[model samples]
Target: MNILNTIRERRSIHTFKDQEVNTELLEEIFTYGSYAPTHYMTEPWKIKIYQEGGKTAFVDAILASYQRIGMLKMDGSPKSVKMNDSMKKFLLEIPHHAVIYFEKKEDLIRYEEEYASVCAFIQNVQLAGWEHGVGMLWTITPYMHDPQFLKDIGLNNEKVKIAAVMQLGYPDRVPKDKGRSPIQDKLEIITD
Candidate 1:
């Protein structure tokens, strides 16, 4: 697919088919993602993929984070218990999870630049994945902010910044486009 069409048609897919996307294919897509612009060639993004049996530990950490933050309350109430169980099952069913992160830069300006570069890399991953009939949901959930969750995933919270945890697989359903406002609404031109 052409870049323009790919950009327009790509969607954030939540539901995925019960299939495992090939590892080699995912590598190729990420290779394309690497072409995204990096400030001073720092190439700040890093990824940790969890799939199959590996997802169990990741899901556990997420649930633990939710409980720690009080977003999930399994207070012996039947409703809360059911909700927790349901969420666990739903997360475990996803075919793959990619945790994207980058080392923390101490300088304020450098940190912003690195963060922006990683964001561009993420967009590239989504676009490249779309061309291969794969779908990705770039999620910035509350669990991502939990220090314990980062430690559970074997990342040092003090040393790295999590950008997103991408849920990836072949789409079971694609949401309809919620069209965007015209560029003119947000754009400002200055010619002096």
Candidate 2:
């Protein structure tokens, strides 16, 4: 498929099929992500791939971290759950999870640049997945950004930050294209 078509057709899929994704396909996706342009060639981004039992481990860890933060309930109570039941419903449903992280730069000006690189990496992964008939969803939840949880996940807290948790799998349902706004209205040209 053409790159532009893939980008336009790709959607954030929440429902995934049970079919297992082969390692070779995953390698291809990661390779695409690795090629995203990075500032200063730092290549600060890192992706932690979780599949099979690993996904379960990740979900559990995230839930546990949320429970520690007390965001599960407004008021502490026995019935208060860290993660809503519905949210948990989808957390364990995906076939794979890729936790994206980026090493922090001491220079504050470069932080946003590194983040933009990570975002590009995410787009590359999603595009690659679409080309390969796979599905993907990028999520940035409070649990993913928690300091302790980040540390527990082996992300370098001193030098890195959790960017997002991306779910991947075969789609259970293919959604129709949701058209985008015209680019002409959104763009501004300056020639001086």
Candidate 3:
């Protein structure tokens, strides 16, 4: 598929079939992902993949972290209990998870650039996965700052930043495309 078409068609998939993503296919996607530009040609990202039974520890840590931070609670609060249960179910269904980490840099500018590069790398992974009919959901949120979660992912260090938590698999269903706003309105041209 053409890049533009892939970009347009690619959607963040939440529902996935109970199937393991092939190791070779994962390699193929990341190989393409490595093509994303990096600062000073320094590939500052590291990927930690969890699959099969390995994902259990990672999932447990994330759920525990959420509970520790009050984002999830089993304190008999109806709303909290419901949300926690739902989130656990959603997380458990994903058979593969890759946590991308950005190695810290001494220079602030380089650090920022590395972060941007990693973000692009992540998008590259998603697009590349799309070509193989794989689904990816890019997530970074409520659990990102959790120390235990960081430790669980083997990134418990001041020098490393959690770039993204990618949920990977074969899609059971593709969501309808929610079109984007016209770029013309958001563009600002300055010629001085």
* Index of the highest-TM-score prediction: 1
Cα error, candidate 1, residue 68 (Å): 0.3
Query: Where does model 2 exceed 4 Å of error?
Result: 74-89
TM-score of 2: 0.88
Candidate 3 local lDDT, 49-118, one digit each (tens): 8888887778888888988988788687898778877887778789798999988888889889999999
lDDT of 1 by residue, 1-192 (tens): 899999999999999999999999999999888898998999999999899999999999999999999999969799999989999999999999999999999999999999999999999999999999999999999988999999999999999999999999999999999999999999999999
Window of ten residues with lowest summed lDDT in model 3? 150-159
RMSD to native for every prediction? 0.9, 2.5, 1.9
Query: By summed lDDT, which 10 consecutive residues of candidate 1 come out lowest?
Result: 30-39
User: Which candidate number has the best lDDT?
Assistant: 1
- The candidates, ranked best first by TM-score, are 1, 3, 2
lDDT of each: 0.95, 0.82, 0.88
Q: How well does candidate 3 score on lDDT at residue 107?
A: 85
Q: Which should have the higher TM-score, number 1 or number 2?
A: 1
Candidates 2 and 3 compared by lDDT, better number: 3
Give me the displacement of residue 157 in model 2, in angstroms: 2.6
TM-score of each: 0.97, 0.88, 0.92
